[model samples]
Target: MAKRAPGLGAVQETMLITLHARARCGDEAAARLVEAIDYDFAPMQRNAGATELFHVLRCAALDEWTRQFLAECPHGTVVELGAGLSTRADRLDNGTAHWCYVDLPDATELRRALLPDGERRRTITGSVLEDGWADAVAADPGPYLFLAEGVLVYLEPAGVRRALTTVATRFPGCRVALDTHGEWIVKRSRGPLTRMAADLVWACEDPKALQDWDLGLTLRESWPLSRPDWVVRRALPRHTRLTLAAVNAFVPRRMTNSRVNLYSVDATG
Candidate 1:
């Protein structure tokens, strides 16, 4: 468990819990992160609208993906950017493999209190835009998976481009999976939720532009929340595949399909 300290914000604390929860099923590292945090996550998680349901759903999808990846990529290294208290290591830890949790210095300081630090499933603290961090990661030679989660959009386009290029050039056979916001969603919406989202991260006009930047547009899957086939997909996690299918049959067409951009970077240079 992580040792506790003062000055950590509740919002950051909650984000950590989300990561741990996603890692709960098979991610022992994630579970350890939860137990390590000094703050209470119940207030945010249990509340009606404190945390976004869709975010949790996204976490579910990623958790499933992480487990499947570990099964297929033994000895491959996995790196989590902006790894705020996320125990993805707990969920995807392979004793023989390497896992690097990277983030900013302040967040790293806070994370150190909640996570164990050392090589082999280690944590690297630095701004994702910086060159030094990439240089360090480039030292690891193996099939790598860069899991950015909800972090890509926070970076300006140049930073995002540089980071991806750096990784692709340094590591061979590396893949990345991350979420993105639609340009339309950002420009058209003026509601409270829209503004709140903008306050949290920068917006992009086109997610598909990733390919132009040399990042392979691997699997462009959409998690449409309002389609006839959406409900069952969400329900299948608890092995409620049948229930999810049943619900999908009756779902409406008007629901918002928040666009998620996932890319797979090939690091074979």
Candidate 2:
């Protein structure tokens, strides 16, 4: 008898890539999940070290923002859009906060098998382009923090706008944390991503441009991945710190073009 690879699309399969990266970064739970899965992760090893560092820094920044939100609103609801094998809830559970992991049916099925729903946390099977998941999240408490992470770049510009607008319209006054790639990165990513059957369609030159959508979103903070805030910077290993410093000094645009952004949803909208 043999185990089977989970039936997931190319973009969904990328979750395993991030899972492997987290495992490489010494995430015990991610490591265990990697061993449990039967897929060939060889392709994911192309740039393993860089992938691990990139994911570590990205997750660290998002985790920091999540921690800050939880600190201010202990019982607020935290919704992770397109959450695929993400161990965020496990990492940032404040005991009282509600957690909702939303994703497509295939991804959600895999996640449900590994990460079971609990009293404080649960999973919803749906697309971010739709509004059904919003209703489920609305049932939870207020002061929501929606995390899109590495999810939106897969969608077209219109789809991205629709998704963000939906969040703003439904969960006003909420906060959203997401990442965006510049056209240069997106163009370069196409070739490699095509091999995995996934593509990066949405390219944002400036995260602040999102405010022009009239979705009631205000860009609260945006920073390049290579230069995270002091909290995230302090947690990095010495090697990673030095590497990022060098990258920041020489090829600044390489990392600066892609950023992690935090936006606040206005209540009036």
- In order, what lDDT does every prediction score? 0.58, 0.86
Consecutive 10-residue window with the lowest summed lDDT within model 2: 187-196
Compute each candidate's TM-score over C-alphas. 0.71, 0.95
Q: How well does candidate 1 score on lDDT at residue 14? A: 35
Which digits, one per residue and each the tens of the lDDT, describe model 1 over residues 34-89? 56556555544444231244455556556555665678887777788777777666
Name the regions of candidate 2 deviating beyond 4 angstroms: 1-4, 190-194, 252-256
Error of 1 at 33 (Å): 5.1
Question: After aligning candidate 2 to the native by TM-score, how far in Å is the CA of 269 from where it should be?
Answer: 3.0
Name the candidate that leads on TM-score: 2
Candidate 1: misplaced stretches above 4 Å? 1-51, 183-198, 204-206, 220-222, 225-255, 259-261
Please give the clash total of every predicted structure, in order. Answer: 9, 0
- Taking all chains together, the TM-score of candidate 2 against the true structure is 0.95
Which pairs clash (backbone N, Cα, C closer than 3 Å) in model 1?
2-36, 2-114, 27-90, 27-91, 28-90, 29-90, 30-90, 172-267, 232-244
